[model samples]
Target chain A: MSSLGSKWKPVIVMVINDRKLRFGQIAARIHVISRKVLTDQLREMVEDGLLIREEFKELPPRVEYTLTEKGLALLPILNLLEDWERNYETKEVLAEA
Target chain B: MSSLGSKWKPVIVMVINDRKLRFGQIAARIHVISRKVLTDQLREMVEDGLLIREEFKELPPRVEYTLTEKGLALLPILNLLEDWERNYETKEVLAEA
Candidate 1:
């Protein structure tokens, strides 16, 4: 969990969770992130066993990124976080009135 | 979740999740962490609204840290991560044989 401390790591994971994407597609989807930083984050995620990187031999030598089983497993936790904010946090604030 | 990326943040949260603890107690539980870094992490957690810090007036000037509702809300996610490692990640490895 501590391994996910970077600001963009979760966002990057969320973007790539359902579909395998090329590096350029990921960068464009998360355009606020710098190319170098996005590259670093992807590399780290791969090292952490949360992502898989595949290279296809073609005229362009395409590379794609996909979430591994370990990575897909994180989606439940992310959904719980969003639900916490939506249900618990917001409800508490409204109650404080 | 990304905010919890530090090596010590998750450990610290686990220590404080069950009961409120003084600074010394928390520091002692996660003893491998340096004092300065522990202090910094605790401060950041407070600022992030994940922790509530209370200071008592006394000759000894005591302070205690507790997880707020927001912080407590993170437990499910953390538990899911643990379950994922124990169940999914390990199962996949065992199956790939």
Candidate 2:
């Protein structure tokens, strides 16, 4: 539960789904999260066994993140959550009108 | 996301599920949460439209809490999360052995 407790973790997982993404790429995708918070969240996710942080030995040094099997398992559940929020928001809008 | 951000919110939602429960009944069901925290969580759930708080004009003035449509909708999602955790724990145990 702690793994999913962070608001950004699920978003990050969704962003990095099947593709491996660099830190900058991930930060760029999620506009609301700050770099520091993103770093922290990524670290936590790696520690929780949800993500794999791989570093490439290059001139500038590149790092990429990919989801582990555990993290991949959350996709369907998160999709459901997104659907629930969408429906909830639609209902709220209708109620307001 | 804020609605489900609290650690106790999901637990409370699961605790109340389909049946209406009094404050004491809810507290008794979840031993770890303090009365103050439970009260706060329930109030937030009601405010978030996840719960309905009804007061009975009985001799003792009983009050009960029940899940709203939105709350009831979370059951399947929460169940999936529980299943994920169970599998995750099992894997952890296997890895440790």
Best by TM-score: 2
Residue B10 of model 1, lDDT score: 64
Best by lDDT: 2
Candidate 1, chain B, TM-score (2 decimals): 0.81
Q: Could you give candidate 1's per-residue lDDT for residues B1-97 as a string of tens digits?
A: 4456565766777789869999999988888888999999999988767789999998899999999888887776777766766776566678777
Q: Indicate the residue-level lDDT of A38 in model 1.
A: 92
Model 2, position A25: C-alpha lDDT score: 98
Question: lDDT per residue, candidate 2, B7-49, as tens digits?
Answer: 7888899989899999999999999999999989999889889
Model 2: reference contacts kept, as a fraction? 0.58
lDDT comparing candidate 1 with the true structure: 0.81
Which clashing pairs does model 1 show? A5-B5
lDDT of 1 at B15: 81
Q: How well does each candidate superpose onto the true structure, as a TM-score?
A: 0.83, 0.93
DockQ scores of the candidates: 0.49, 0.69
Error of 1 at A14 (Å): 1.0
